[model samples]
Target: MKSFAEIRRIAIARKGEHELAARMPGPPERPLRDLSDDRVLAEFSRRIFQTGLSWKVVDGKWPGFEAAFHRFDIARNAMMSDDDLDAHLRDTGIVRHGAKILSVRDNAIFLGDLARAHGSAARFLADWPATDAMGLYDLLGRCGARLGGMTGPYALRVLGYDGPLLSKSVVAALNMAGALDGAATSKAARVRAQEAFNTWHEESGVPYAVISRTLALAVPD
Candidate 1:
């Protein structure tokens, strides 16, 4: 793998320093403010609902979603009766997809369970090491409903966790760097990819989020 310095230089040339800086994820000191178990579940729900759908549409209807789901309060949403979910089927304000709606309730249950097991969902996420992003993703896949694929990491990003997300651009950059054979989807591949990022973090003394953004910016869109 190319040194992070070399990769960052290439990214600066390709995207310009200003643009690259803008695209970079925030430092750890700046938390994704107002994060709570409920908000985390809300962001997870947002990502799940946006899958294979128009993000624009989903974003525009977010208020309705907050209202419909009681702002994704973990306890309230976990207790969402079958009738409540059924009511959303006809609610035009938000997306009417049945499976996604069900996933929200499922995810709420997941978060509630986590709270019971580990104080709160926020504490669990806050305590996880950003360097082990793949490990955290694995945990999310197991404990959180419908948090497979990129959804888990993307949700983490949205919730202000400073970690690497295997976004398309980042994955392409990793492939170019010979970090892995292809997309790092399988468990073994993901583990290898996470180790690469950890190495970069060690080399640069930079946060994983910044290293991830730098690598992504190094690649052409």
Candidate 2:
């Protein structure tokens, strides 16, 4: 794998320092350990709903979603009644896709289990090693509802877990760097991708999230 410095240099050259600095994923606004479980579920729901959809439209209706979901209180959602679901389908406040709506309850139940084991889902997420991003990805896919593909990773970053996102451009840059081949849609490819990012992070002490964005920026539009 190429050093993060080389990749970042390429990104800076392509995007310029000003834009790069402006756009890079920075440290979490609040410490991850302190993040509320409700907010964590909210992010998961947001990413799930946003997949293959217009993010702008989701953002616009987020208030309604928040209200409908009671700000994503974990216990409340984990116990969603069929009647509540039927009501959500009839409500115009949020996207009413049955499966996606069901994911909210499922993920909440998942989080509730995490809290039972870890005391809080926040601690479990905040304490996970970012170097093991692939492990995290695998765990979410195995356990969390509808968190396969890019959904879990996107939600993780938004939840303040600093890790690489296998976005299209980032995947292209990984292939270019010989760290990955074809799409990183399989488990082995994801492991290879994580190994590459771990090497870059160890070599340069840069956060995986920034490295991911840098790699994407390295690729021209």
Candidate 3:
């Protein structure tokens, strides 16, 4: 495995190379403020939730998803009729997997309930205490939320959550922080990754959004 320094060197070397430009998908250049709308936030979460699926597929089918899910209106989706769900499952543009679609709807309902209980999703998430890796993994397991892995936490980090999120971007950020070697593999890698993030935030004079964009673009599909 390459050391964190080695990975950084590779990343720096590839930064402006024509070949890399051709191969690397650039992150969306739009400012994070543009993505702060509730609808946009829902879409962003949906995209991340659809990780295993191709972005091309997701983008192309987004219209179908939007129509099917009432444009992802949390309140409306929470009360979706069975006919609505059936129609969604029948739609060819979006992923028609029954369970996956159901999960989306279920998550919406759950999110609504959470909001009602906690006041707001943002507040709920914010109020949730910061946690370490094992703690996060356990929480996900308890929630019966599928598709989240160690990488899920990192994804949250890149998404700008104040608390822990274990996703690849976090891993890369960790390497940049020198908390973990780029190639380092261990349970403690996550903790080290968090430390690295803190350091980068302090020294790089760059915002998390920029760092996230850089990291997202660096990832190979």
Best by lDDT: 2
Q: Pick the candidate with the highest TM-score.
A: 2
Which of the two, 1 or 3, has more TM-score? 1
The positional error of residue 124 in candidate 1, measured at the CA in angstroms, is 0.4
Residue-level lDDT of model 3, residues 25-46, one tens digit each, is: 3344443233323453354346
* lDDT of the candidates, in the order given: 0.86, 0.91, 0.53
Q: Rank the candidates by TM-score, best first.
A: 2, 1, 3
Stretch of 10 with least lDDT, candidate 2: 1-10
Span of ten consecutive residues with least summed lDDT in model 3: 31-40
Candidate order by lDDT, decreasing, is: 2, 1, 3
Q: Where does model 2 exceed 4 Å of error?
A: none
The collision pairs in model 1 are none
lDDT of 1 by residue, 1-221 (tens): 87788889999999999999888776443365436788888889999999999899999999999999998888888887879988999899999999889888889899888789988887788778877878889988987788988898888876778779888888898888878888787899888889889888899898888898898889988
Clashing pairs in 3: 4-182, 153-165, 153-166, 154-165, 154-166, 154-167, 155-167
